[model samples]
Every structure is written in structure tokens, then in C-alpha cells.
Target: MNYPEFLSYDIALAACAALAVLITLLLLKAFALRHLQRLADSGRLHILRYAEQVVSSTRLPFFTGVALLAGVSQIKLSPMQDRWINYAWVVILVSQIALWGSRIISVAIGNAVARQRTADPATATHLLLAGLAGRILLWSTAALVMLDNLGFNITTLMASLGIGGIAVALAVQNILGDVFSSVSIALDKPFVIGDFIIVDNYMGTVEHVGLKTTRLRSLSGEQIVFSNAELLKCRIRNYRRMQERRVVFEFGIAYETPQQEVERLPQTLMEIVSADYLQTRFDRAHFKGYGESGLMFEVVYHVLDADYNVYMDIQQEINLALLTVLRERNVSFAYPRRMVHVTHLAEPQESAGQAGKLAA
Candidate 1:
């Protein structure tokens, strides 16, 4: 194509300068990226992960912005051209900074979550929200800066957005509240996934923690879901967190049972407990008092683990063992009974007997 003779030299010079700047920055970016790859391959990236983030996120736009600024500076241009170049560079700067900031947010939050992964498996929730928050902040600031650089009134725009945001918040207050509660659950970690918890009347293992609701797999083999906000308001009994389970049981023996047998009952119970002390702690066993129809005995013990199935199995074993011991000894458990007495009175026949004697 034919170029205007008067502008040919200037155009060639500008093109050459732009190419030089672009190539130089590209080489620099390539070097940084190679270093990052080396760190990754050596398994040492964990220590320099932040530096990696900066390098990776800035690789493209960082060089582009520098090249464009250099190219524009090397050539003379009208006011309009200068303004356009400035806007383009500012966009690249804002975009690159936002990208790097977002990566930083991700790395920081991920490290924190990794540290807490053992304690709270819902850590991903917190990490996600934190990274989202950081990106929103970065982009929002970039937007404001871009507008200000473009000579717009940021204060008025922010005020308008504030009012609109309030309206939006009102429209979705419940949803927003639940979202915040989910964030709280993520951070505070009252109960995590797979934790058996009792919330109000609902008992289950948490299956999912979501922005709106938490899902549970109930004992009845069905799913139960509750709003995150409502769940936070309830009293939650996290059975999974219990280190041990305290058990109390009472039984009645017949009143006719001998005192010797009554005394031996406790010993039998102790033996039964001692036979299986692997996970149970024997507390006490004694004849408590007299019931309406029998003698009452109370026993206390603790299961060393929080598993409900384990606890129930051990309890059933104890119950069966106690029954067997009593049966073997011919000791009987009590049931309600009653005793009745009958008395007959002789009726008086004194008048009849006297009349008969007179007639005779």
C-alpha cells in the first residue's frame, strides 16, 4: 500500500520503536515465567508462591501496558491521540493490578484454609468468599480510578450506587442474611460436614453447607435442609464433638428378692462392665431405693467414644448380660401385684330361734 510521503518516515519510526518495546517486555515476561516454572518443578513454589502469583498474573498485561506506553511516548501525537493512549494504558494498569490482587487473595486465603483444614473442613467456603471479596474490592477500586482518570465524578457515582445498593439489599435481605450466616458458619465452624448435630429437633450429619441452606442426612435415612440464617439461631448439640457419652440406667427387682442377692446384683453388674472396659468406664452401681412394688437400683457409666451405634451396642450387651446373670441366680425382676382378704360375719337369728322354743 502507498503511504503519504510526508508521514512515511514518522510511521516507520513509531513502528520500529513499538516493536522494540514489545519484544523487550516479552523477553522479560518470558524470563519471569521460566523462573516460576522452575520453582514449581522443584516443589519450592510454596515458599515463593506470592512472588509466583505476582509474576503469573502480571505476565501478559504488564508487558502490554509497558509496550503501549513506550510506543506512544516515542511518537508525537495530537491531544486526542495522547488521551486515547493514556486511557488504554490506564485500563491495562487497572486490569493487571486487579488480576494480581485477586491471585494474592486466593493464595493468602488458601494458605489459611489449608492450616485449618483438619479442624474445619468447611474451610473452602471461607476461602471462596474471601477471594470473592478481594476481587470485588480490587475491581471496584479500579472502576473508580478509571472513571476518575476519565474525568468523571466518582463521588456522585458512588452515592448513586450506594442508594441502589441499599434498595437491592432490602429486596433480598433474607437471602443476604443467609449468605452472611453461611460465611459465619464457614469462619466460626460451629459444625462441619459429617458432624452429627442436633439442631432444635433435627438430628443428622451435615452433608452440605451452601450459601442458602445446610443439608443433613438424618437418622431416618432422609435429607433435611434448613436455611443458613435459621440454623444459626438454633441451639446445636454437636454430638460428634463429645468425647464421651454418660449413660444412666435403672432397674427394679422383686421385693421378695433376698438382700444377699440384692447386694450381689451390683457385683455382677461390675463384673459385666469389667468384661468390656475397652470403651466403657464403670462409674457406680447400687441399690437406690424402694419402688412401689420392688427395689430400685441405679447404675452409671461412660462410653469412651461418641459413636451412637457403638454406645447402643454396648448398652444392649450390658442389658442382655444383666438379664442372664439374674436368671442364672433365680433372681426375678418385679411387676405390680395385689393381695386381697375376705371375711364373713354370721347373721343373727335370735327372734326365730326363741319363737320355735316357746311353741315346743
Candidate 2:
């Protein structure tokens, strides 16, 4: 039986050496990771945690391939075989690097999110998205680098991708717009989950902030969905951020209200607002103007609390108190009324006869 020309004692030795290297590498990886884990668990060195994660991510296949490449480099082979081995080595190296980068990004972002989870949940959510984006970018760059190392024309590939990407972007432009807008919302923090927001005619509490759509739980017990892109385009009133509720309300009194009471109305309103048990900051109250059917007064005050229910309660109390005071003062609440003054007009003959009598 004739053996292949490449099979020789040197090759046999190289094979044994490769096996030893592989075993050594595996053992080293195990021991190093175990030691690092212990150290990391001790919480003495913060950086060992990262090292442990990166080292543990080292795959058995990658170690095996590395050992094989090292052994093969010591042996003589055909030019084609050498080229293939080099390509394989490049792939292993790039993949491992990508893994390390991905691990680092995950760790860093995860720590950030954890730290901010309670302090600022919105930022934590944004960090999660950022981590995903980073990992994607890392892997994409690694793939491109691996391809370039394997003798692919990267520039031409990139140009083709650019054109293809444009077409794909055009096809999914709306989705992409919403996705980008979601990022904007996350970064800018225009609104966050649990924030009561008003956009145009829609008002609701933000239930979920998603890449494509934000869900809102409306007061009417229905979920309102809005495209993130369109949501950002509209004016958003974030009521959650309001520290106090500024309330402006107007009421009219009967035009027959006494002048002295009207003069004292502003102070009366201030007392009513300030005297309420619920916390309120009186801004101002004035006899604003004369309405079509009555005298209008505008009152502005601030509820010390941001809660809508609390504001409503305070307002109700104020209304009831005002009603009582008005009744006591004989001031009636105004209603829509039309008062017509009629004048009798004599016929043309009567007017002419009166004129003739005056002349005679």
C-alpha cells in the first residue's frame, strides 16, 4: 500500500504536538476561567469579571482550529492547502474578536442599565437598545473583515451593499422611520412609560414604548396605538413631568350682581381657593370681562399636586364652596339669556298726520 507523499514522520509529530497544544489550551482555559470566576466573585477586582466573561466565551472549536493552524504552519503542504488554512485562521481570529467585543458591549451596557433601572427606567430602556445596536455593528464589521481577509473584493461588495441597502431602505422606509423615531424618543425622553401624554385629540397613559408603535391606555378603557414617527411629529403634552397643575377656569355671574359684591369677587375667589383643605396656590382671580349674557370672571390657580384626580377633587371643593358663597351673597350663577328691548313704531300715515298737525 502506497501512502500519500505528505504523510511522513514529521507530519506525525506535528499531529501529536497539535493534540498536546489543544489539550493544554483547553486545560488552561478551564483553570484560568475558574480562577477568574473566584476572583470576580470575591468582588475585589471589578475588571476580572469582564475578563472572565471574555475568556469563558472562547469556543472549543476556535481553540481546536487555532491548535490545528499552529501545527500545520510547522508542516510543509501544497500552496492551496496553506492558503485555506490561513483563511480558516482568519475566520477563527475574527470570530473570537467579535465575541469578545460583543461580550464587552453587553457587560458595559448591562451595568449601565442596571444602575439606571430604578433611578431612570427610561434611560435603562434606551441603553438596552444601544447594546443591541452595538452588537449588530460589531458583528457586521467582523464579517466584513473576515471576508476581506479571505480575498473578497470588499470595496466592490460595500458599493453593492450600499445600493442594495438604499433599495431596502426605500422599501421599509416607514418602519425605519418609526424605529429611528423610537430611538429619538428614548434619547430625548419626550415621554416614557407611565407618563400621561396628550397628542392632538388623543390623551392616554403611555403603556408601552416600542420601536414601531407606542401603546397608550386611554381613559375610555381602549388601547391607543400610534406610530412612533407620527407621535414625535405631533405636539406631545407630558403631564407626568408637571410638578403642579395650573388650572384656568371661567365662570359668569348674573348681570344683575351687585357692583359692591363684584368689586369684592376677586378677594372672595382668592379666599375660596386658599381656604381649601387641598393644597392650592392662588395665582390670581379677576372680573375678566362682561360676557354676552353675564359678567365673566377668570380665575387661575395651581394645584400643588400633579395627580389629575387630586386636582379634580380640589376643583370640586372650590366649586361647591363658591356656589355656597354666591348663594349667601345673593349672587346668582349666569345662564344664557337674550333680552330684547322693543320700541313701537307708528305707521307712515300717523307720522304724516302728526307732521301736518304740527305745520297747521
Candidate 3:
């Protein structure tokens, strides 16, 4: 190729080559991105979505840097200048790779969350935190790689960071503890959003599970918030996980009732409970013990449903049935009462004699 006197053939050729490579890379990237988007939108292949995300994340600066690096490699330059240029190239490549890695992580996490969002909201929430941590780790590694290429002591720097990290950890130990507890909650799944949970003295429906705190909507229309760390330390009763509810109830009839009827009470109870066998399973009904006012009968059963309302409805029907049966059988529910009798007696023989003497 012919060139002007001021410009050498090699320099001109290098310049032309750099320009061509830059244009080619840009055109190829655009074409691939457009194709990948179409494939990703079709949802036929999940890998295409990830590829699209990575390709789209490639910034123009990276393309320019790569082209400049390619063109400069063909030119004559001082050793120090070449070394710096190589360092710049490493930075550009590592940064873009880190960006692509971050996008991939987000895409993966987002897809996973979407899949589980309807069935397992708590898991979806945890996946977001996991993605953030993954991206942070990816970028940190990329930075370290760039530093290593640029002739920095990464091992020493890591050691220093380790020591400093300990102090920082100690300073923010409370926050870190809650974060760890949030991770534990996600993994262990003690309770999830929409679960009716009882923690210590507080009972509520789980409204939100956050990194530091978990919030609940109480039955009485109050919001209760608990630190995740503290929540983990306490016992959690997740009613949503319960399959059936066990019920124990005690009632008393008048002690004056016939012994024959008392003996038949257990059988009567069994019949009453077994009538709703589809909803309840009768365990036992027995004359438990004597109460101050009546003979106490204890009944144990399990409601086949976990819903509180269903249990209450079944209980109410059983109670009304008991009332009707007792009334028909001429038996009465017990009430606290006392009986007193007054006896008229001669005041006293001595007092009577004294009164007689005084009258005489």
C-alpha cells in the first residue's frame, strides 16, 4: 500500500487494521445481541437469555480498548509504555468480564425467583440476597485479578483485609448476626410469608421476612416486628405447617345426677364426636375427675383441618349438641351453690330453767 511521506506504511496499515477490527467487533456484537434477544424472548432455551444478558452488558469502552490494544501491539514503543498499555488492557478486560458476570448472576437469580415466587415467596426473597452476594464476590475477584496482572501483591493485600475485616465484623456484629439469621431462616424455612406463627408471646401472620427484621400482622390489627437474630433464638410455632389441630375440652354436669347417667356420659360423648368423623377423630372421652361443683368430663379429639375457623365451628356444634342432649336427658349443667339448714332447739336446758325460774 502506498502512504504519504510523513506516515509510514506500517503505521498506516496498523491504523486501518484497528479501525476495521473496531467496526467488525461492534457489528458482530449488535448482530449477536439482536439474535439472542429474539431467542431469549421465545423462552425455548434459557441459556440464550443468559448469553443475551452478557452480550448486552458489554460496554462500548471495552470495544474501543480492545481495538486500541490490538493496534498498539503492532507499533514500536518503549518497554515501560508497553507494560502500562498491557496493564490498561487487563483492567478493561477484567472489568467487562466482571460486568458480564454480574449480569449473568442477576438473570439466573431473577429466573429462579420467578419460578418460586408463587409457591415459595420466602425462597424467592432469599435468592435476591444470594445474587447480590454473588455479584459482590465476582467483582472482588475481578479486581484482584486486575491487580495481580498489574504487578500488585494480592496475597498480602488479602491478609491485610482479613485482619481489617475482623475488626469491621466485630464493629457491625449485630447487623452481621441478623444477616446471618436471615440466611438461616431462608435455608431452614421455619416460617414463610403468610404463615401464622407464634414466637414467644407474640402471634401473627408473617408479613415480611427481611435481612435484619421480620414483620408480622397480628390478629388484633397490630404490626409486630422482631429482629431476625432474636426471632431465630426463640421458639417458633408455625401453624401453617400444622396438618391437624388437637383439641382438649372439659365440662361438668351436676353431682346430683344419677350414677347410671354418669356412666353413660362417655358413650354419649363418643357418639357426639364420631358423628363428625369426617372432620374430627375422637381420641377419648372419660369422666375425668370430681370438680367442686360437678363431675368433670374431659374429651380429647383432633380436628382434621388445620384452619382455626373450622376448629371453632366444629367445637361450637359439639357444644350445642351437648346442651340439647343434656336437656332431653333431664340433666343440668353444674353451677356453684350451697345449701344451709336451720335447726330450732331449746336454747339450753340451763337457760330454759333460768327463764322458768324468773317467770315463776
Candidate 4:
């Protein structure tokens, strides 16, 4: 065949191939979606089921289209040009396949690990960390593969990347520290989502754990982001870990109260704390000392939970109960007072009377 006939034949062949691929992709999509529907109807499908189906069905046609277009482009190019074009297209297609395949495999593995971790609470956090690490590794590998396919010397490229990454690490040493700290936090399970934490007076619940920063939803409904490095360095009080919270309170009794009543104060406060459901375990009470205006007594007890609201409620109830008991027992709180003497006036009157008698 002459050059023009050869060109025509190639064009026709490429068109036929493109049409066949398009039609095949459409049929495959339909078959896969139908299979997904059947699985969904069987009640065996989970969160990952639909996700896998969508990714597979979408990528199949998308990649088929890319390949077809690349093939058609190759047909119109010179031999040398076609070689480069084919290389680029193959790289693109391979990268896409790697990405999609990695995603599917990751999803399946993550789901399986999650299911197993659910049974073992201790492993849940580890599984979550593993899942995230897998995703990062997958994408990183995909990127390297694409670069390698583009005629780049992978060994040299990797060495250069390592050097550059080291520079970046040095430049953002603090940030990198925080990111690693966040990973440690996740793995250690120091605090999880919805746990209340106190860090340097910033009290809030952990809302999210991200790559570099952690988000906290404050009691006032404000979102706060803290660097994980700084957070890990600071003293973190996780209230959720407290089995029981200790409540300590002080009250004053009037000095005028009888000695016997004052001695009975400690026992009375203990009884009050022990009688309430809010008190987990009562420790002890003491007549601490005399205050500026009153006699002070200290009461201590533990609450069942570390929740702020629950603690406050228990404290309030105990206070009210204490007041009621004190009033019934005729124990009155103290108030400041002053006493004045009139001795000078009395002496002057007596002297004046003596002077009058002498004159008479």
C-alpha cells in the first residue's frame, strides 16, 4: 500500500480499536454495577463495598478511554515521535492502574483490620495508624513508579529526594517534630476522639487528630488547633482517664458554738458526704484551724466520674446537704464583730460624785 493508503488503513484500524474498547468498557461497567447491586441486596455489603465498586467501575472506563486516545495519537506520529508518545502513555496508564489498585487493596485491608480491631480494643488505634500509613506508602510508591517510567534514574532521583527531604526536615524541624508526635499520640492512645483533656488551662475535648496538629473543641464551642510537638511536651491531663475525682471543700463554724459541737463537726461533714450517691468514696474531714473570722473545717471526698458537670452537681448537693445538717444541729456560721468599753466615762462620774459629797 502507498503512504496515503497506509495512513488511511491505520486510521481505520485505530478507530475500530477505540470503538471496541469503549463498547467493552461500557459492558464491564454495567456488569460490575449489577454485581454490586446483588451483593448489596444480600446484606453482605459494607461501607467499603460500594466504594470499591465505584472506584473499579469508574477507573475501568476512564483508563480504557485514556488508552484509546493514546493509541490514536500514536498512529498519527512519526516512528521516533510515536516511541516517546507510547512511553509516556504507558507510564500514565501504569500509574493510574497502580493508584487505583492500591486504593482498592488498601480499603479492603483497612476494613478487615478494622473489623478485627473492634474485638480487641487495644489494637484499634494501631490498626488506624496502620491504615493511614498504608495509604501514604501507596501514593508514595505510585509517584516513584511514575517518575521511574519517565526515563528518570530512580536511584539518583531517590537519593536527591532524600537529600531534599532532609533539608526540608531541618527547615521545618519543629513542624516535623509535631507531626511525629501526633503519630506517637495516635499510637500510644493517650487520648482518643471525644476525650476531655486539659493542657495548660486550655480544657477541651479532642475533636480530631491530623497529620501535624490536633483539633480541640473547647467547652465554649471554639475549635482550637495545637501543635502536637508542643502538646506532647506540655503536661497533659486527660480527664477521661480519671476513675474517680476527689472533691475537697472548706467551711467555717462560729466560735460561739459549744466546744462539744465544734468537735462533732468533722463527723457531721463525713456523714453528709457518705450519704450522697454523688460521693464515690469519702476520705476524711478535719477541723483544720481558726480562720480570720470563723472556725474552718475541711471536707474531702471522691466522685464517681471526672466529668465537670457531674463533679459540680455532686459538690453542690453535698454543700446543700451540709447546710441542712448544720442548721438542724444549731451550728451557725461565724460573722465578724467588735466590742467597745465605756470605763473612762464611768470613772469620771464617780469622781464628780465624790467631789459633790465633800462640798456638802
Clashes (backbone N, CA, C under 3 Å), per candidate, total 0, 0, 0, 0
lDDT of 2 by residue, 1-360 (tens): 346645676688788878988999999999999999999999999999899989888889888888888888878779999999889889989999999999989899889977876688687778777887889899999999999999999999999999999999999999999999988988889887678899999999887777799999999999999999999999999998999999999999999998999999999999999984769999999999989889999999999999989999999999999999999999999999987899999999999999999999
Off by over 4 Å in 1: 1-26, 37-47, 59-76, 119-133, 183-189, 192-194, 198-226, 233-235, 246-267, 274-276, 282-300, 308-360
Least accurate 10 contiguous residues by lDDT in model 4 = 117-126
Give the Cα-based TM-score of candidate 3 against the true structure: 0.63
TM-scores of all models?
0.63, 0.61, 0.63, 0.76
Residue-wise lDDT of candidate 1 within 148-248, one digit each (tens)?
99888988998999999999999999999999998889889998876889998889988777778999999899999999999999999998889999999
Q: Give the winner by lDDT: 1 or 3.
A: 3
For model 3, the superposed segments whose C-alpha errors exceed 4 Å read: 1-111, 117-129, 138-157, 340-360
lDDT of 4 at 206: 80
Instruction: Give the winner by lDDT: 1 or 4.
Output: 1
Model 3 global lDDT (CA atoms, 0 to 1): 0.89
Encode model 4's per-residue lDDT on 1-360: one tens digit a residue.
Answer: 899999899888888777777777678767777777777677785654745455564655465756477458737777887767767676767666666666676666566656755365335445556667777887788777777777779999888989999899999998889879978987787887667899998989886676688889998999989988888888989887799888888888888899999988788777778874654688999999998778988888888877778889888888898888889989898777676776645588899999999999
The collision pairs in model 4 are: none
Candidates, ranked, TM-score? 4, 3, 1, 2
RMSD, every candidate, angstroms: 8.5, 8.9, 7.8, 5.5
